[model samples]
Target: MGRALAGAVVAAAVAVATLTGCSLRIEEASCGGGEYPVLAVNSGGGDCVPDGEEPAQGWARYPEGKVPEKVGDEWDIYWSTHTLDENGEIIELPEGG
Candidate 1:
């Protein structure tokens, strides 16, 4: 009886671990249908705009080489403290950035 109980407990533990592991997919942040994301040029702000619409005033498309594909991704992190000047040059943000 003791051996059987211990075997059952081990099986249950394995089942629990398998179930949890199967559900551990990392979901990516997304912009839902018909919209795309853009970042504010000189600030830590962003938005999702419709596919046919342009970024609003004070905001701009991320530069070709540095566009972020996911929230908190490498490019996204870099953009938080950097921006493009009017001439399209990359510049470090001011203090308190």
Candidate 2:
């Protein structure tokens, strides 16, 4: 029957491309007072202290709603004026650590 309907449409197009081609990769987490300025999403990577500096310990990934807390798995410290929000924009916090 038409090769079983073309093998069920190629197995439903490879299961919808593996569930929408997956997405969640944000590495680089290690701050000791050098090379700051980072912003990863998906749940990993952070360190963008841009408000006078002097706050770069480790962990930081805010870009989904200005996450103030609830970030574990990594995050020693990160200010950046509380992850920006008050006209400077760049808020949507919430990923992981």
lDDT of each: 0.77, 0.47
Can you give the lDDT of residue 62 in candidate 2?
46
Q: What is the TM-score of each candidate against the true structure?
A: 0.64, 0.19
Residue pairs in collision within model 1: none
lDDT of 2 by residue, 1-97 (tens): 9999999998888787789995444543443344444443323345456545553343344444434332332333443223443344444455543
Residue 95, model 1, lDDT = 76
Kindly give the stretch of ten consecutive residues in candidate 1 with the minimal lDDT sum: 22-31
Clashing pairs in 2: 46-60, 63-92, 63-93, 64-92, 64-93, 65-92, 65-93, 66-92, 66-93
The total of clashing pairs for model 2 equals 9
Regions of model 2 farther than 4 Å from truth:
1-30, 41-44, 47-88, 94-97
List the RMSD of every prediction in angstroms.
7.1, 12.9
